[model samples]
Target: MKIDGSALIAARQKLRANFPGRGEIGSPSIGTQEWLAEQAHVSIRALQYLERGEGSLSNLKKVCTALGISQWQQLIINYGEDYVSCIANRFVDFRPSIYPPENPETFANSSLLMTLDPLTLLVAKGKFETILLQEVNATLTGLAEPITYTWLAEVSLTPNGQGWLGWVKEVEPMNLLANDVPMNVPIMFKQLCVPQVSWGAFVDAVENLTTSQLNIEVCLIFQNFTKKFKVYVSVDLLKILFNEGRNKYLSPLPYRAQLKAIV
Candidate 1:
């Protein structure tokens, strides 16, 4: 994705917002560009470029790490009002709010749940397959479902002769559960099933899960029928789930072992 220049500028403003004396150029504690350059192991020229929001991702990550911050989001929030306002305005335009009065008709359906199919789920799982799994697991538990699933396709396995089609029955949700929860409690299950098991049926089933918030327990199954099916998920959903303590289940043991073996 192309970097947002305005956001980058605002992020810089946010980073320097609280410097002593409103970011006086000579404040010793604030650290000079030269000092930051040396600390980050980057050239002075590179540091200058980064300050101007023209640096590469590697340089940006290094500088951000040295400065003890997360991503550029923090920078935008910490900067002055201008930075915050710019981001707010940009986001509003990007994803405008639908307040009741302004969007009464929309509000009528606000509580409606949207169901997603396998392809939709895959798309939503994109960079956050882990988050997607956690959400799926949480949904299952909350609804008292009896099965859970981990897509073998994600691990690059083909469907044939008990290869990717084999389901890891009674796969433990122990790892997926919140640590605060008592381990002895009978964990709920969501019947784990894969689309390829009944490709047409799987698509419809996923759609149902996505649309409704009903409590129902069902067996989960997995099967691989196709050799070339791919899905993508949204980054925002992943971030939301990650923030809401649903980051577990993104990768299960079998997948991890497969990754390790490949490496």
Candidate 2:
């Protein structure tokens, strides 16, 4: 999966030569190192390494993406066998199937997620049960009209102790699902779960039954939100709200503070 240095250099040179007025490897405009770095989603320094034909498999793929080359392996063919590298195609052999709704299940990877307004849910008219709640309620706690904000929540059902427990992380805008309506404030979520359920009715008894991350192999995917999908979030981080962030968790919320400190 990794690219040979000579191959990358040669490929880049060929691409540059195709452009009008393109001269050097790091010339002005499209040929600039900075521009290429942006396209590859790497830093200026990383681009320097890329030009030398040295980078990890992930970076090589990024470079391929920037250069608009679909056959990433082709980059290696030009480098001669000495620089050519290969890795097992694990994804081709393993992809989890969607779970049946008749029984509960969990997933092995993450999927895309987004926030929704309860009022919007009302208008949409679907089956939305409050599965799990933390310190705050899923609906606004009696906030009058012009209720600009509400808590983002995680809901789920546990059947026989082997149910789907989802893990989520809000993804960046560029990582949003292709061609989906981007969210407003706090947007899309990357969810990880298993194909445990499909179109099955949830027993009222399990509505409040808290599900744990037990007996489940996770599956991940970056998906757009649909009326059919449900949201599952960590209790501590689900306080995502617009402008005034659910207001239930005080300012400098634990999650926000931790994120800021890390960043």
Clashes of 2: 24
In model 2, where is the ten-residue run with the lowest total lDDT? 254-263
Report the lDDT tens digits of candidate 2 across residue range 93-114.
Answer: 1011233232124321212122
Which ranges in model 2 have alpha carbons more than 4 Å from their true place? 18-28, 74-263
The best candidate by lDDT is: 2
Score every model by TM-score.
0.25, 0.25
lDDT for 170 in candidate 2 is 25
Q: CA lDDT, every prediction?
A: 0.30, 0.32
Clashes of each: 34, 24
Output the TM-score of candidate 1: 0.25
Instruction: Give residue 190's error in model 2 in angstroms.
Output: 59
